[model samples]
Target chain A: MRLLLTSATSEFGRTVADLLSGDHEMVLTDQTRHAEGHPDVVACDLGDDDSTDRLVAGIDAIVHIGHGGHFSSASDLLDVNTRCTYNLLTAVRNAGINRVVNLSTLRLLDDYPEHLTVTENWRPTPGVEPVILSAHLNEYVCREFGREGGIKIANLRLGFPLVAGNTAAAAASGESAALAGDDLLTAINAALTADLGVNAQSTDAPHPVSFRTVHVQSPFENGRFLLKGAASILGLWEGQGVA
Target chain B: MKILILGGNGMLGPWVVDALGDRHQLRITDIGEPPETTHEWRQIDVSSLDDVVDAAEGMDAIINLSVLRPHRKIAFDVNTRGNYNMMVAAVTHNIQRVINTGPHYQLAGPSYEDWDFDLNPDMPPQPGTRLYAHTKALGQEIDRVFTTKHDVYLQTLLFYHLYDPGDIGNGPGGSGVESLGKDMMTPYSIAWPDAGEAIRCAVELPLERLPSRAETYMVFADVPHSKFNNSKARGQLGWQPRYHLESLWNKR
Candidate 1:
């Protein structure tokens, strides 16, 4: 499939680009304007109409791994995450691109200090604290796009991305190395090839909505996938009947 | 057998009634008569422990889907006191399952800046704001106590938004209809369906296999950016959701 991979300059994006390049035609872009080794890079600012328009034309699928800092002001955060996503999806629909892989953070699920292993069915209790609530808003936008567009949307939430060989500092800094590029590649590959029907809705055969949310995390070697991103990849793979 | 539902007229109670109604003996009680169909109806204030006990007697399963009224005192009364009363009644009555509605806040808390970790069902309840959320947290705590002390199966479902095409015009009161649609379908809202599936699993799964504290499930489509997890529900309980937000909303 022809792919548009955003955030190509980020560490994880670079890894995914390298992994997928051998088998797929990849078009990479980022707000940074310059990606070191990628020659087909484009400067697409999600905030700009022209940039969104350019990215949406002719791409079969989008790996929207783009994100900015969380703003203290709720409105600013919404503008950046929620509205920015809205612009992209609208552009994608207009351009007739129906498949997307939305890269989301696990923080959207963190509602308390007691630690919760959230499932896709949990709904944000309105009036939540701003930061987490804003993230939830971003998640909501993605699903809405899928519902309205009938686009095949895959949301992969990563915990702290593990930078290879950065264990000591990574641990002390509380950064997760789990969401690294290679880790994402596993999920991306599975999504690319997997059937979504099985994972798209319950096996009980309910009619699917325009959207689906699959957890992608590293699977436990025992054949169980946990770690957000791996689970989604496996579920997508299982849904698709891909080996 | 005999099933009792607190706030039986609310969002999920009606569905639970439909799913289990024909199979088991069902009795429903709520403060107001909910619009849907059900087997039996009794008027009861869930906030009052006395009323809860009276209604809970002679039921196999007690499903509570009432939203705590926003008044701090009332919210506290119904959510905290009323929840405790329901737990005690279940224990006393030997109800097979106690399914209470839980929201996303049970897993997602105030400390997070953005998505990072998939909600782990094994994680303990987190800190939250709002009297309603506070009460829900308390209900989970009470459930934990009952789960251990009485061997009663206590399940809390952190439900997602239930939207109908008809609701789009008026929206959810304060929010505009268009914005409500935009907000409800987001990736973070994925847990909406898992809430129902969690309830289903709670009733279907054997008590011996349930988690010690509480469990959460996601019930929406597989969106790429979501932070919830459904591994335990799928792997442990072998359960899955039967509906997605759009289908659920549009179908009925």
Candidate 2:
């Protein structure tokens, strides 16, 4: 499938590009003009409507790095996540690209205690930290677009400090919420191909719409966040961690 | 108490100034020049965090009336990032109270407006992709995050159509949408002065008296259609509409 990946120089950008490059037709873009040794990434400011529309044409799906990282300041975070995202989504829907896999983080729920079974149904009490709060804001924009029935958004909230190895290594790194790279790839693949509906992932919303949130984490047992939404909506299984 | 009013030269700003001008000390800020007022005014842009932070210093509370509907770039700047700057500045200065104003669609857009009635503000905001509603909703969401995380109180008063009591049918371009002859007006509509009064009510209400750290009030009057419910605002803020918009529902 043809895909457009945004923030191609941000955190985990190179890793995602390298991993997904062989499998699919990739068009990568970043706000910055140049990345060392990789010249194919088209420089397109996601905030600019003309640039985004030009970039979005002929794209089948999008993988948006929704977590607001790799920026200059708090203003950059606010603009990129809220304004640039709004522009990007508006351009996408206008261009008839209906599918988006917004990459968010599970840290928005880190405030909850260890014992509680935190799932996608539970609302994220996002702290004032710009990155986390901006991520929550990204989900809001995606949900509204999905709710409008113009797009089908699968907001995959991945575990933090996404590591590129087995779960054993990730656990050894001491970040309890670490997600293995393979699990991350699999979740994105599922989101890209899933039959998303208004009520696909969310069970608690009285009137669920197209935007779905799935908590994707590794070591599928006794993790900080439960995977009810990912299991049902993204067709994720425990074996996929090792598969 | 001393209050900082952002976008204090806009349409709703004067009404808010009218409501609170005599009672509380107000410091007004806007990108444009202000109306003739004895209170202090500053030419500030809300999208700039530095500008907002500087404007918000030493104030007891901040009231944001900034809104830009038509232009996309300026709209997002003023509407989306403006809220971000407000919250950050509020926390920076340790200001505890803030009152924000936006259209009702910011919380309940066409997703609710098209199909539902008795629409309250507590429902999850589903503001579909209309520019004004979408932009303003993002601001509200930003404000919600700051309220949850910081040592601050947020009160948002949402209004729909704004009408003048004397010029009910006589706004720009002759007979307006708020006329007496209208059979079915938007149930979320409120008069301009009443909208301002809602701000005063939000400001005066004690923080301890608030039911929650963050509260949103659907700032409409007692209309007949009952399409939107103002019970929360009425019960909590004790705000009653001084203008009788009987001509809207009762066409006598």
Candidate 3:
């Protein structure tokens, strides 16, 4: 399948691009024009309506991995992040793209009990933190679009993506917050191809699309996060491809 | 200055009346009868637009302390719609300043069980699983919208845990004192007097000193390992909470 990966320059996007290059046709785009080294990446700002429209055309699926980081001012965070998601999803709907995979953060569940293990069924507490709130709003936007009938959304609420050089060490150390790059790729691939069933009695369309929020984290002993559903749903297991 | 307080019969109302009653011309309103206080009192429900307009006339500013319990129909009506009503009335009646009170459920804390960070006031609201958090967040959003459109200055003061001084000595096993030592909400506690003083500062702060037409501040006592940052309250309002939760434990 043809895939459009947003924020292809970021660590998450770059790793995804590297892993999925052989299996599928990938078009990578980012706001910053840093495509000199990489010939396949196309520089496109998701916040720009025209740019989003142009990039989403003929794309079979979207892997939304772009967001202003946690340190952005509240105004910029809300305006840019929400606008990007809104613009991208709207354009995707118009383009008749059915599959959307959004990269949400585990921080959305940051307010849950520290001792309790979190799962996909855990509801997000998107309190006043700008980044977490924006992530929740992003998921809400995806769900709204999915409810509109033709779109199938898989929102991966991933833990901290492991850094480039030290992922193996981090995974070996059993850091609860770390998610290996290979595990992220496997989750994304599952989201893109998983048969998430159907919503037969949808209000907007006779066959409403399926929207699922899955938690993605590397296996850690006595970790605070539960990965039971991710193993079953995304076909990912702990230490799946670690060298 | 003539200040109209909606929901003045709430838990924090009497203290607020005591804090500012000596200086400001205070008019207290709530659905219940006014508590025995020196200030003028009236029975007014904020959910009613006309009722709010009637009470808001001739007031220089308004302080909205009204809160709705979750799982009730009035939670949305009073918390969300009531806030909208208060803003409309404030604008219609030419009230220049409005102080709104909400809980700190919007911040990452006990309700968010997984969030383990010291949050500042500037952080966006989370509004976890609780209906009250969502409604209060909607109210703050309404405040933002109205402040942008109208000439009103709005301050949303989000409070954490509130406790009365008298209740501090009630021992650990009392009905409301059960959660005193609970890690989730212990350090975030605020005294009634401090809450009142914070409200007073929100009311009296000069409009020129305000950074924006709409601002939010987290009001709570200084606690060790506090999840909330109250620097906005300190820098902008020149307010500091005098009471600490540690003092309560120490006294007990």
Best by lDDT: 2
TM-score of chain B of each: 0.79, 0.94, 0.90
Better of 1 and 2 by TM-score: 2
Model 2 C-alpha lDDT per residue in residues A1-243, reported as the tens digit of each score: 899998888767767877688778999888854344457888877765587789899999999998834756777777788878889998998998888999998888889986788888888878877787788888888888887777788998889788888667666667767888877887888999887544435567744356888988876445677776776777777443322
Residue lDDT tens for model 1, A150-187:
57777765545443432233334444223334445766
What docking grade does candidate 2 earn? medium
Question: In model 1, where do residues sit more than 4 Å from their true spots?
Answer: A1-243, B34-38, B113-115, B165-185, B190-198, B211-214, B244-252
- Where is model 2 chain A poorest over a 10-residue stretch in terms of lDDT? A234-243
Write down the TM-score for model 3. Answer: 0.52
Q: What is the TM-score (0 to 1) of candidate 2?
A: 0.92
What is the DockQ score, from 0 to 1, of model 3? Answer: 0.02
Tens-place lDDT digits, model 2, residues B1-252: 899999999988999999999999999999997779999999999989999999999999999999999888888899999999999899999999999989888888887877888899799887887889989998998898888777799999998777876666432333433466564454766778888888999999999998777899998878777678899998899999866566666654
Q: Which ranges in model 2 have alpha carbons more than 4 Å from their true place?
A: A33-38, A197-209, A238-243, B169-178, B181-184
CAPRI verdict (incorrect, acceptable, medium, high) for model 3:
incorrect
Ranking by lDDT: 2, 3, 1
**DockQ metric for all predictions:** 0.01, 0.71, 0.02
